[model samples]
Target chain A: MDYAARNFAAEGYHTTSVTSIVNGLGVGKGVFYWYFASKDELLGEILGDALRSMREAQRDAIAGEPDPARRIDQGIRASLHWLSENRHLFVLMEFARTEERFAPIIRRGDDQMVADALPHVSAGITAGLLRGEDPVFLTMAILGVSGHLARTLVLEQGNDADRVAESVIAFCRQGYLATGTPALARRSA
Target chain B: MDYAARNFAAEGYHTTSVTSIVNGLGVGKGVFYWYFASKDELLGEILGDALRSMREAQRDAIAGEPDPARRIDQGIRASLHWLSENRHLFVLMEFARTEERFAPIIRRGDDQMVADALPHVSAGITAGLLRGEDPVFLTMAILGVSGHLARTLVLEQGNDADRVAESVIAFCRQGYLATGTPALARRSA
Candidate 1:
C-alpha cells in the first residue's frame, strides 16, 4: 500500500498504472493480481487504511479526556502527529481529492472525521463552553485548520507536534470558546 | 492561457500532452509552439495566470480598506470568491501540489500570499487592535485556515463562497482581535 501510495502520489492516478506499481515493487503481475482485484480497489484499500489509522489515533488521543475542549486538543494533536508520521500518504490523500473516481474515498474519510468530532463539539456548545456553532461548519473549520497547520508546521517546518497541537487548541478556543477563562478553555465534552 | 488552464485543470497536467491541448483547440501543434516553449512551460503559465487572477481579486477586495481587520476580511473573501469561481482549476492546483516539479510555482504563490497578508496583521497588532501575535506564525495560520476552508467550502462543496469567507473572518477575529473581544484563550497561530 505504501509503495502504491507513493507511486500514485508521485504520479497522478491516471498515470500510475498497476503495471508501474508492481514493476516498481519488482513484483510479478500475477502477484499483484493475486492480492487485489483491480487498481481502483487497491487504491480504495489504501484510502481505507489511511482513514482507519487516523480514526484510531483520534480515538486513542481522546480516550481518557473528560473535558470536551481537551478532547478537541487531543484530537488535533493526534491528527497532526499522524500526518507528521505518515507524510507520504498525505500526497495520496491529496491525489484522491482531485480525481472524480477517487473523490468518494476522500469524502468518506472527511465525513467520518467530522462525525467523530461531532460529539465533542456539540458537547462543548451544550455546556455553554463553545459558541452556537453549526456542526458542519465547525467540522469544516477544524479540518481546514488542523490539516493546514499540519502541513505548515509539522509537515514542512518540522515543528514540535505538541506545540502545533496547542496552536490548534488556541485557534479553536479563539473562535469557538464562550466568553471567559482566557487562559485555556475548559471543556465538558 | 485560459485554454491551457481548462485543459490542465480538467485533464490534468501530466495527462495533458501538447498534442492533446492543441488538437482539442482545433489548432495545429505549430500554433501551440508559437506561444509557449514546451508543455512544462505552458503548465507553468497556466498556474501563473491562476495565481495572478486570485491575487488581483484579493487586492481589489481590500482596495478601500484602511482598517487591518477589514482588510483581512476583504482579502479572505476575495480569495474565496476566486476559488469558488474557478473550482475546476482550484482542484487542479491541489492536484498539482503533489508533484515536485510543479512545487516551486505553488511555493512562490504561497509565499506571496502570506507576505501580502502580513502587513495588515502587523498593523492591527501594533495599533493595539489585535492580539499579540508572531507575525509569521499568525500569517501562516491564517493562510492555512483560509486555504483549507476555501478548499472544503468553496471548491469542494460549491456552496456560498462568500458566507464561508465570513466564517474565516470571524475565525481570524476570534484569534486576532486584541482588545474588543471577550476571553477566548489559547490560539494556535
Candidate 2:
C-alpha cells in the first residue's frame, strides 16, 4: 500500500497502472488481484488509511487536554506533523479531490474533521476563549490555515514543522494583529 | 476555451481528451489543433488565463487603498469573489496542481501571488498593524485561510460570497480570540 501510494503520488494516479505497481513490487498478477480488486480500490484504500491515520494523530495529540483552546492548538500541531510526515499521502489526497470518483471520499474525511473539531471549537466559544462566530466556520478556518501553511511552508519550502505549527497556532489564537493593539472592531460594527 | 475548461473541470483532466473537447464544442479536430496544439496546451492556457484574471481582480479591488491593512482586506474580498465566480477554473487549478506536468505552472502562479501580497504584508508589519512574525508566512496563512474557506464555505456550502469574505478577513485580521481578550502571549513565552 505504501509503495503504491508513493507511486501514485509521484506518478499521476491515472498514469500508475496496476501492471506497474505489481511489476515494481515483483509480484504476479494473481498476487495483486488476490489483495485488491482494482487500482481504483487500491487508491481508495490508501486514501482511507491516510485519513484514518491523520485523525488518529489529531485525536492522540489532544487526548486529556483540559483547555478547549489548548486542545485546538495541540490538534493543529499534530495535524501539521502528520501532514509533514505523510507528504505523499497529502499529495494523493489533493489529487483525489480533483477526481469525481474519489471526491466523495475526500469530502467524507472533511466532514469527519469538522465533526471531530466542532466540540472543542464550541467549547472554546462557550468559555469565551474563541470568537463569537459560528463554530463550524471557525473550525473550517482553522483547518484551512493549518492545511495551507503545511503545504506551502513545510512541504514545499522545507520549513521546520514545529516552527510552522507554532506560527499557525499563534495565528489561530490571536490573528495577525500586533500584540497590545486593540482588536479590530470591524466585525462588532 | 470556456467549453474546454468546463469539460476538464467536470471530467478529470486526464479523462477529458482533446477529441472530446472538440466534439463537445461541435468543432473539428482541425479547429482544436489550430487553436491549441494539444490538450495539455489548452489546459495550460485556461489556467494561465484564470490566474491572470484573478490577479487583475485583486489589483483593481485594492486600487487607491492607502492603508496596507485595508488593501489586504480588499484583496481577500476580491479573491473570494473571483473564486466563487469562477469555481470551475478553481477546481481545474486544484487538479492541475496534482499533475507533475502542470504543477510548475501552478507553482509559478503561486509565486506571483506571494510577490503581489508581500509588500502589503511587510508594510502592515512595519506600521505595527500586523504581527511581528515573518511577513511571508503571514501572507501564506492569509492565502490559505481565504482559499480554503472559499472552497469549503462558499463553493461547497453555497454561502454568500460577501459574508464568507467578511468572516475570512475578520479571522485574518484578529484571529479566533473574542474581543477584549488579552491576545495570548504563548509565542512570547
Candidate 3:
C-alpha cells in the first residue's frame, strides 16, 4: 500500500498501473492481485486509511485535554503534523476528489472528519468558550482553516508543522471565540 | 468552449476526449485543432476563462465598495454567486487541481485569487477595521472559509447563494475583525 501510495503521489493515479507498482517492488502481478482487487480499490483503501490515521492522530493528541478550546488547538496541530508526515496522501486524496468514482469516498472521508471535530466544537459552545453558533458550520470552518494552512504552509512551503499549527490555532481561536463588538466599535474605543 | 466545459464537468477531464468534444459540438477536428494545440491546451483555456470570469464577477461586485470589510463581504458574495452560477466550472476546476499538468495552472489561479483579496485585507488592517495579522494567511483563510461554505451549502445542499453568502459574510466579519482578546481572556471576562 505504501508502495502504491508513493507511486500515485509521484506519477498520478491514472498513470500509475498495478503492473508498474508491482514492477517497482520487483514482485509478481499475482502478489498484487492476491491482496487487492484492482487499482481503484487499492486507491480507495489508501484514501480511507489516510483519513482514519489523521483522525486517530487528532484524537490521540487531544485526549485528556479538558478544555474544549485547547482540545481544538491540539486537534489542529495534530492534523497538520499528520499531513506533513503523510504528504503523499494529500496528493492522492486531491486526485481522489476529482474522479467520479472516488468523489463519494472522499466526501465520506470529509464528512467523517467534520464529525470528529463536531463534538469538541459543541463542547466549546456549551461551555461558552466559543460563541454560541451552529457547531456544524463552526466545525466545517475549523477544518477549512486547518486544511488551508496545512496545504500552504506545510505542504507547499515546507514550514514546520508546529509553527503552522500555532498560527492556525491563533486565527481559529479568534474566529470561533471573538466577542461580538464590531471592529468599528473597537477602533473608536 | 462552453460545450467542452459542460462535457468536462460532467464526464471529467480524464474521461473527456477531443473527438468526443468535437462530436458533441457537431464540429470538425480541424476546428478544435485550429484553436487548441491539444486537449490539455483546450482544457487549460476553459479553466483559465472560467477563473477570469469569476474574478471579473468579483471585481464588478466590489467595484464601488469603498470600505474594506464591505469589500471582503462583496468578494465572498460575488464568489459564491459566481460558483453557484458556474457550478460546472467548479467541478472542472476541482479536477484540474488533481492533474500534474494542470496543477500549476490552478496554483496560478489560486495565487491570483489570494492576490485579489490581499489588498482589501491590508486596507482593513491599515484602517484599524480589521485585527492586524498576517494578511497573506488571513486572505487564504477567508478564501478557505468561503469555498467550504459554498461547497456544502450551495452546491451540496441546494441552498441559495445569497443565503449562504449572508452566513459567510457574518463569519468572516468576525474572523477578520475580531477584538484582540484570547478565548481564555473572553471566558474569564
Candidate 4:
C-alpha cells in the first residue's frame, strides 16, 4: 500500500502501472494479484488505509482529553502530524482529486471525516463551548484549513509541525467556537 | 492548449494521450507532431495558460477597488467563478499534485499564485488595510482557505458559486484582518 501510495503520489495513478509496482517490488505479476484483485482495488485500499490511519490518530489523540477545546486541539495536532509523516499520501490524494475517476474515492474519505468529526463538534456545541453552527459545515471548514495548512506549512515550507499545529488548533477553535467576547488569537511570527 | 487542458482536466494528465487528442481532432500523429513535441510539453503549456488566466482574473478584480478587504472579496469571487467554469482544470491539478512526477508542474502554478498575490497583500499591509503580518504566511493562509473553499463550493457540494465565493471572501478576510473581533460569519446552516 505504501508503495502504491508513494508511486501514485509521485508518478500519478494513471501513469503508474502494475508492472512498475512489481518491478519496484522485485516480484512477479502473480505476486501482485495474489494480494489484490486489481490495480484499482489496490489503490482503493491504499487510500482507505491512509485516511483511516489519520482518523485513528485523531481519535486516539482525543481519547483522554477532558476539555472539549483541548480535545479539538489534540485532534488538529494529530491530523497535522499524521499528514506531515504521510506527505506522499497527501500528494497522492491531491492528484486524485483532479480527475473524474479518483474523485469519488476521495469524496468517500471526506464524508468519513465529516461523519467522524460531527460528534465531537456537536458535543462542543452542546457543552456551550462552541458556537451554534452546522456541525458538518464547521467540520468541513476545519478540514479545509487543516488540509490546506498542512500542505502549505509542512509540505511546502518544511516547517516545524508542532508550532504549525498550534496555529491550526487556534484557527479551528476560533472558527467554530461561540464568541463570548470572541477574540482572535494574535499570531506571532 | 485548450484541447490538452480539457483532456488533462477530464481524463487526467497521465491518462490523456497524444492519440486521444489527435483522434478527437480527426487529425493524424503528424499533425500533432507539427505543434508539440510530447504530452509533457503540451501540459506545460496548459498549466501556464491556466495560471495566466487566473492571474488576469485576480488582477482585473482588484484593479479599481480601493479597499483591500473588498479587493480580496472580489478576488475570491473571481477565483470561485474561474474554478466553477474550469472545474476540470482544478481536478487535473489536484490529480497532478498526488503524483510526484507531475507535482513539480502543479507546484509551478501554486507558486505563481502566491508570488502574484504577495505584492497586493503587501500593499494592503502597507496601506494599513490588512493586518500587519508576514506576507508569505498570510498569502498561504489566504490560499489555503480559497483553494479548499473553492473545492467544496464549486466542485463538491455544487453550491451556488456566487454565494460560496462571498463566504470564502468573508472567511478569509476575517481570518486575515487585524481583528480581535468575533467571527460574526460562522455558518449556522
RMSD of 4: 5.8
Q: Which 10-residue window of candidate 3 chain A scores lowest in summed lDDT?
A: A180-189
Docking quality band of candidate 3, CAPRI definitions: acceptable
Docking class of 4: acceptable
Q: Model 1: runs farther than 4 Å from truth?
A: A10-24, A175-189, B175-189
lDDT, residue B97, model 2: 85
Model 1 per-residue lDDT tens digits across residues B76-128: 77888888888766877787677777767887887788888899888866766
Q: For candidate 1, give the lDDT of residue B10.
A: 73
lDDT of 2: 0.91
- Model 3 ranges off by over 4 Å: A176-189, B175-182, B185-189
Q: Candidate 3 lDDT, tens digit per residue, A1-189?
A: 998998898777887888899999999999988998888889999999998898899889999989888788888888989999998998788778777888888789888988888888888877767766677877777777777778777887788988777777767766422255453322111
Q: Write the per-residue lDDT of candidate 4 for residues A1-189, one digit (tens) a residue.
A: 788778877776777899998999899999999999998788778877887888898889889767665566677788889999999888777765665666788888888887887787788767766655455656666678788889978887898787777765555544312233233332212
Q: Which 10 successive residues of model 2 chain A have the least lDDT summed?
A: A180-189
DockQ of prediction 1: 0.35
Deviation (Å) of A135 in candidate 3: 1.2
Q: Give the TM-score of candidate 4 (chain A).
A: 0.86
| Model 4 segments more than 4 A misplaced | A126-134, A173-189, B126-133, B175-189
**What tier of docking accuracy does candidate 1 attain?**
acceptable
DockQ of each: 0.35, 0.77, 0.38, 0.31
Q: What TM-score did chain B of candidate 3 earn?
A: 0.91
lDDT of 1 by residue, A1-189 (tens): 888887776666667888888888899999988999888889999989998998998999899878776677778888988998888787688877876777878988988898999898888667666666575677667777889878777876789877887767666657422233243321112
